[model samples]
Target: MSKFEQQLNQQLHDLAKEKAPQRDLWRGIELGIEHQHDTGTVPQNRHRRLAAVAASVALVVSLSWYGIQQTSVPATDHPTGQALVKALSNQHEQQKQALLVQYTDAPAMTENWEAQLAELDEAASAIKAALKEDPNNGALLRMLQQVHQQQITLIERVHAPQWQQI
Candidate 1:
């Protein structure tokens, strides 16, 4: 089609017409095998090397797991964590209810706004369940806060003025 493609095709065609190697390719391999047998030099067992690599990986993984377990804070260790989570949850609920009340008469820009809110609520419920198990988890706390913020944001966006969106 193009000049580059024509050149590529011509080169491939030329290579296809070239003669193959004249000598037997297996002769070199057979000589090497005979030489090794004469010298009594055996090839190293591949399984032993594979096993050593596997053992090293296993050791490193186990040590890393142990280190992580030792460093992480236990769920039940922090007595005030659950109280804090409950307080935050209560505040978020109140704020959400107030927001809904304020926007009760406003029509949402998107038809699926309620469905989105429901999904966020479900995510929040799951996070709360996880918090019950590991109350002191900082990452989970942050995720819960983010999800709550997102719910509030989504509500505000859907009810916001079209000019404000622009």
Candidate 2:
């Protein structure tokens, strides 16, 4: 071994022979325990407070979620509702036609895409019929919009998948 390693070993031997300084730790621990007992407050109280806070937070979150669901779409009268529906339908048709023209020669990934589109169209028609009866129904309007979006997403996915580009 080199001189540095020999010196390190000698230091380690000297440390091993030395005795540790002694102190009474039990008195301090006992004092702390007595003080805690006198205060009448335990760790369980902290846990209870944490649980209560968690419950309140959960309740607030649930209420906010419920409120959002209830007010997602605003109610509208017959004329305004009909106009909105017509506008959305016109835009969807234009987009669909444009996409079809763009992918005329490209083959779709799935053979049943046309059937899926037909199903979504039928659903849209049903929602429209429901809207005619209750023009101010916000939920129905939301459903119609969701179905239209789904149709567009399906068309896009079938024509040009993200994985295909990679």
Candidate 3:
């Protein structure tokens, strides 16, 4: 079970009405029993259990909503940075999927593509390192590859007339 569940269970069990104010426990029980009695009678533990369930649901929903908000925000495009980010995203997904499966790669990919891919791979490595130091920044991580791509490609192609072909 999760920490939330564990805490809830402890709270439920530790509701000892003894030395710690009988009035409060009685009030809770009275309120619970009144609700139960008004609803034409229910089991003693039902209200307590319901309260715990509602708390758990609220906690889970809050966490899920936060996650959705985080993932739903769009990243801004920065040309080569965008391309590099796309590649990194592909790799991240592959890494996640690898936990559940295995795959094999073809033997004869091009050396030229390898060098281009390596530049991206290096940038991704640096971005990941930065991310480890600051995990809250999805944009920084996302911008990593694309930023380097623009710099590297521009330096290599700036003198050539055919850069427009890029």
> Candidate 1 on 1-166: residue-level lDDT in tens?
9999999999888886667898888999999999987765664455567789999999999999988986797856644578878878899999999999999998888899999999999999999899999988999999999999999999898998557766
In candidate 3, which residue ranges exceed 4 Å CA deviation? 1-111, 144-166
- The clash count of every prediction, one per candidate, is 0, 0, 3
Which ten contiguous residues of candidate 1 have the minimum total lDDT? 39-48
Compute each candidate's TM-score over C-alphas: 0.50, 0.52, 0.26
lDDT of 1: 0.88
Output the better candidate (1/2) by TM-score.
Answer: 2
Candidate 1 matches the true fold with a TM-score of 0.50
RMSD of each: 18.0, 17.0, 23.2
Between which residue pairs do clashes occur in model 2?
A: none
Q: Which residue pairs in candidate 1 have backbone atoms (N, alpha carbon, C) closer than 3 angstroms, thus clashing?
A: none
Superpose all Cα atoms of candidate 1 onto the true structure and report the RMSD in Å to 1 decimal.
Answer: 18.0
lDDT of 2 by residue, 1-166 (tens): 9999999999888885666659888898999998887885777688889999999999999999988976885655324677878887899889888888888888899999999999999999999999888876889989999999999898888999989876
Evaluate all candidate structures by whole-model CA lDDT and list the values in order. Answer: 0.88, 0.88, 0.60
Which ranges in model 1 have alpha carbons more than 4 Å from their true place? 1-79
